[model samples]
Target: MKPGLELGNTAAITAKVTPDMYAQFEGQIVHRAYSTVSMVYHMEWAARQIILPYLEADEEGIGGGVTAKHVSPTAGGDTITATATVTGLKGRAVITAVEVHNGKQLVGTGEVTQYVLPRSEIEKKLASEQAK
Candidate 1:
């Protein structure tokens, strides 16, 4: 990490719902509404934006955990926004609180945690897991 990452920092991404984002399982569409998977993906992207400018050349942010809930349905073509706010930072972990909204309606909410580690350390961990 570089410097100046602090709580209350926020980032957001807006996207229009599409067929591909619909709830599905094993290639079968389960619902015509936006999926929890897509919501979480957008949430992570929004959170990642907060750390992008602060990461050192040798540091990378990896997903540590995610907690999400799908509270409302958004149909295709409805624009949605996922926003992330930095809520905590401890050691190498950055925690964010996230929300997904369609206009004034809250579609979902979640928390994301990311771990900043040296790229070499991450690669070594991957290699060891693969070797196992």
Candidate 2:
């Protein structure tokens, strides 16, 4: 965690729906609409923006968890916007509230949690797994 990180800090990102973002089953349309999973990616991107400017060279934020609800369907070519607001911080944990919209209509909402840690610590953790 770094200074200037506070509750109410927010970031927003926009993405347009594409054919690849739609749901498919057996190469056919499952619903012919943007997939809920794709919205999750946008939500995470917005969450990442909230902390990127505050991170040190040796520090990084690792995603911990996300929970989202899709309330509406979006067709391909529709522009979607996702926003994240910092809601809380507990030690190394940073929590954010996320929302998605198509224009002004609310399409999704979520909570995203990320753990702030040292890059060296993560590298060491990966190395430990290789050592085993």
Candidate 3:
């Protein structure tokens, strides 16, 4: 793994918010704008694409944690773009900084940590657990 990767070195990813992605809340006149939870989902997906190429096919990569602040609101009919970059690698974990922009506005920012391991080993471990 490479070191010294900085924040804001980004990979661009975009998605259109559709009805299927909205959240419904009781007593709310309309379904809330795509929730921050949903936005974060896209953010992580973008981050994965950015780092997946760096991982070997038989390697295991796990998204361990995320910290995000939802700064702006986006409703349906909007297109959101997420950018993620490798910021640091500590031991087996890779840290990423991510930002999401809706059209011309910055909507959210966050950091995510992922763990890398050999995929074959991870699968073997899972199978062992299942067998027990």
Clashes of each: 0, 0, 0
Q: Per-prediction TM-score, please?
A: 0.97, 0.92, 0.81
The list of candidate 3 runs beyond 4 A from truth reads 1-9, 25-32, 128-132
Candidate 3 or 2, higher TM-score? 2
Clashing pairs in 2: none
What is the Cα-based lDDT of residue 57 in candidate 3? Answer: 64
Reference-based lDDT, residue 81, model 3: 93
Clashing pairs in 3: none
Error of 1 at 104 (Å): 3.5
Report lDDT per candidate: 0.96, 0.92, 0.79
lDDT of 1 by residue, 26-131 (tens): 8899999899999999999999999999999999999999999989999989999999999999999999999999996999999999999999999999999999
Cα error, candidate 1, residue 2 (Å): 1.1
Segments in model 2 whose C-alpha atoms lie over 4 Å from true places: 25-28, 130-132
Q: Which one wins by lDDT: 2 or 3?
A: 2
The candidate that achieves the highest TM-score relative to the unseen native structure: 1
Model 1 lDDT at residue 130:
100
Task: Give the least accurate 10-residue stretch of model 1, judged by summed lDDT.
Answer: 68-77
Deviation (Å) of 114 in candidate 2: 0.6
Candidate 1 segments whose C-alpha is farther than 4 A from its true place: none
